[model samples]
Target: MWTEVNNSLHRKFEFKDFSEAFAFMTRVAMIAEKMDHHPRWTNVSNGHQMFLQTVACKNSIQFINRVFAHSNQ
Candidate 1:
C-alpha cells in the first residue's frame, strides 16, 4: 500500500533479483519520458533483493501496475 508523508507518496517495493529491479527502473524511465512526468526515486539493493522508493501518485500507480505484471518471471 502507498502512504502519504509530508505531501509525498511513499511505498516499499520488493524484487526477487537485481535484474528485475534494473528492468523495472528502466521501464520507469521510459514511462516517465512518455508521460512527461517523473517521480523522485531512490533504489537500494542487497545481493539479489531490491527496494525502491518513489513519489508522484499517477506515475507511481502506473509503474506499480506495469512492473508487478512483469516481475518475478
Candidate 2:
C-alpha cells in the first residue's frame, strides 16, 4: 500500500541496477502521461522513490488515492 507522506502518496522500489530503475521510470512515465498526472520522484543507483500529487486538483487526498491505485498495479 502507498503511504501518505509529504502531502503525497509515497512509495519506494528497489531495482537491480540503474538501467532497470530507469526502465521502470519510463514505464511509469508512459502511464502518468496517459493519465495527465505526473509524479515527483527521485532515483539513486538502484533505489527509487516516488511521490504523487495531482496539481490540477485541490483535494490532494483523493488525487493521491487514485494515483496510488494506478501505481500499485
Candidate 3:
C-alpha cells in the first residue's frame, strides 16, 4: 500500500532477494517509460522503495494513478 507523505506517494516492497528486488525495479522502469514519467526510488538489501510527487500544472489524478499502479505492481 502507498500513503501520501511530504507531497509524494510512497511505497515499499520486499522481495526474496536482491535479484528479485532488482527485477521489480526493472519492471517499474519499463512501465514508467511507457507512461513517460518516472519516480524516485531506492534499493536496500531485499527491499525497494519508491516515491512519486505531484507535478505542477499536471493532472494529479493521473499522476497518482500511474504512481500507485506501478508502485503496487
- lDDT of each residue in 16-66, candidate 2, tens digit only: 999999999999888877777778899999999987776666637565456
Which stretches of model 2 miss by more than 4 angstroms?
63-68
What lDDT score goes with residue 43 in model 2?
Answer: 98
Q: Give the TM-score of candidate 1.
A: 0.58
Go through the candidates in order and give each one's C-alpha lDDT: 0.53, 0.78, 0.75
Across 34-64, the per-residue lDDT of candidate 3 in tens digits comes to: 8767778999989988877656535243455
How many residue pairs in model 2 have overlapping backbones?
0
Say which prediction, candidate 2 or candidate 3, comes out ahead on TM-score. Answer: 2
lDDT of 1: 0.53
Candidate 3, 66: how far from true, in Å? 4.7
Report clash pairs, candidate 3: none
- Output the lDDT of residue 16, model 1: 80
